[model samples]
Target: MKNELNRNYSEVTEFILLGFRTSPEVQIPLFLLFLLIYMVIVAGNISMLVVIKTDSRLHTPMYFFLRNLSYLDLCYSTVIAPKTLATFLSRGKQISYNGCATQFFFFALFIGTEGFLLAVMAYDRFSAIRSPFLYTVCMSQKACVRLVIGSYICGCINSMIQTGFTFSLRFCGENRLDHFFCDVPALIKISCVDTFVNEIILFILSALIIITTTAVILVSYAYILSTVLKIPSTCGRNKTFSTCSSHITVVSLFYGTVFFMYAQPGAISSPEKSKIIAVFYTLIIPMLNPLIYSLRNREVKNAVKRILFRKKSFH
Candidate 1:
């Protein structure tokens, strides 16, 4: 019976993105605004990566994870921002089926990778704070590399499964997507067939990724807090808090929006609200990550100053 419906409904080859539709007067200003955002995202993430690589002082596990994060932000922003910018400038914002699937694949991949990477970073902080003498041994170079590689592997596996399931459904309804990008919820909503199984899989995957990572982060911070409070000196506690504050801020911002978007029951989900939340995680968060880290961390500021001073002397 379902097969009959699937066969009868015409398959969708392309999708129209109704991205933040607004008055004609607002379009150019919006375009310019996003253009500036994309530029800053590119320059900031890349510059942070360069600083981390060039400075030996940032060779620790925390900075290693941070470098991975900056790289992830760069890739994540590229996946959505360029296409979004194109949609703003052009009359038609159409994406082919394959192109849409490819976009979702990478988007999901990076998102999953980031979730686990944040957990790994939390563990790194736990080790540094709880076992300062053993921090080096606990988060060894080999261990760090393995953890990073494992995060990417998990992301790839999850993306392959979700993207395969999502695209396998027959999209027979209107080809227009309410959101800017090829998001899972938007795609699932447009499918002709019952998306019960797809939704189930999405829920399971999202719960496993988000809940597990959030749990790990909470646990790490719990122990970290205990350790920090045990320190007798107020100065030591302040320094310890400073080290983890930026990461905590970033995690809260990323997970808050993500959980709101993906973790909600379908009945209560509003497309408009989801799109607005999507903007935060996809665009705003990436732009803010470098700023948060650099501004909050004294070491990064010093490193940047040293790099600039060296260039000045060389010239």
Candidate 2:
């Protein structure tokens, strides 16, 4: 009987991900729409990464973080995009056990890194704006690289702990995940083993992430605002505001969707609601990030114009 039971358990290899609705009418349209979105997102992020790498003027600490952020956005989208694109076509969404775990691992890592990276960028801006004389000393190249590396390392460690806890849970029978992606909350709900420990750890991690990132961003912006107010020239004020506004907007969009999705009570968050928010985080934000930053920053525009002019001359 024990051997038979072990065989039955081992036979469960794949998991069915019940992604979105089953209506034929909706699936095709959604697939086309998400395909367009995925293309745009990939293109936008790649362009930003290329621009940062090629442009000498963008070698500052702020742009360094922006480059890292672009990379993170690319990675963050990759974790969810292909699977999401496939979902629009597959009659029933199916993700293998190992595949799901891999998704969760990278997803957690990049998203967590993004939070820390944004905070670091905000601090960079704050130092530049508030302590213009000390900006170089404060955000030196070595220091900036170290900070970004530290953020990535922290994210990796945090993700390992979370994924480790999640993987430790014994999944017995029900293999159907109600949502599109392999999210922690959705996966934990169906675990045959107790998830109390997971919940507590998740809560602690969530609180630490929110509190630490929020504190850093808030303090940075507070200093920035103070410096902005002191600027006597209207043009200077506007320029400063324009420079930071795009970053603020992207930050709000990314954090707002994440906080809303995770901080809310599970009882009130339906699968449909989760899908809507996930769309913002996974697709829309990645696509818009490059647009927002490039359009607002004068440096990027001039670089693009020069690049296009060079192309024209060559042709």
Candidate 3:
């Protein structure tokens, strides 16, 4: 009841995001750097989406998930990158309460969707490698569509819960968020009321999302690895491993940073360290996804080559 009373007297209308407290000399340079990264993230993800859509040969269950992943990365980058860039360029980095809440919602939505999608992709690989003959029947068009839709639904549900709980807290004073964006942990840190319930909810949700996804990915890869080892020819084994390696690399990069950020005790979290880690997953990873997939996956490379050849011929 006291908590309810505290909530009734909410005070903060806006938050000033103290984004990366760097020297004045470096602010412009930092802004330019992030602006460049944002542009690359946009171009790379869009190109991958276009290439996958246009090339009939690329329209498999794998590429279907890849297309969704690209779209997620695109949206994810937009949620954080532009705001971070603006903070670097401008003197005042104030975000209205509504604006902050909206950012947190989409950020949670896309991040959760990506986590689920990565697990789904791992399962897709497992089916392809372990049950080659049954791969088509296993990952049918309807099944693929359902999996993608399910990911989005899960993301929406999780984000709604997270956003609701985080915003319910009464943030009365100290509206200065010591992070580049309005993340849940950052918001919870500033609330005047007891946030024990919010923290428990955050921990449980993070554990469920991170653990379940990581477990699925690990189990899928375990079976995948066993199946790959059983292949007779060394060349075939190498090719199979190559196909799985890109996904593994990306998963490692993403899950490592995210787990450290959310899964740890908030008392141990340093805003400076969190900001750097956030930059990696939120900005660098999205830009790197296309490069990693395209450079490593032979089919994507060939598709890009084909598209370029056709364009050159036309010109």
Best lDDT among the predictions, by candidate number? 3
Per-residue alpha-carbon lDDT of candidate 1 for residues 212-237, written as tens digits (9 for 90 to 100): 99999999999999999999999999
lDDT of each prediction vs. the true structure? Answer: 0.90, 0.84, 0.92
Q: Over 4 Å off in model 3, which ranges?
A: 1-10
List, residue by residue over 1-315, the lDDT tens digit for candidate 2. 112243245333557887776688988888888889888888988998888887788888888999999899999898998998787787668889889889999999998999899899898998898778999999999999999998999899889998999877766667788888888877777677667788778777866886798899989999899889998999999999998999899989988988877665562237778878888998899899999999998988887887778789998
TM-score of each: 0.96, 0.93, 0.96
- Distance (Å) between predicted and true CA of 202, model 2? 1.5
Model 3, range 1-315, lDDT digits (tens) per residue? Answer: 224455566599999999888899999998999999999999999999999999999999999999999999999889998888889877889999999999999999999999999999999998998779999999999999999999999999999999999999888767999999999777887788887888788888988999999999999999988888898999999999889999999999999988888887653247778888889999999999999999999999999999999999998
lDDT of 2 at 84: 80
Between candidates 1 and 2, the one scoring higher on lDDT is 1
Ranking by lDDT: 3, 1, 2
Q: What lDDT is obtained when candidate 1 is compared to the true structure?
A: 0.90
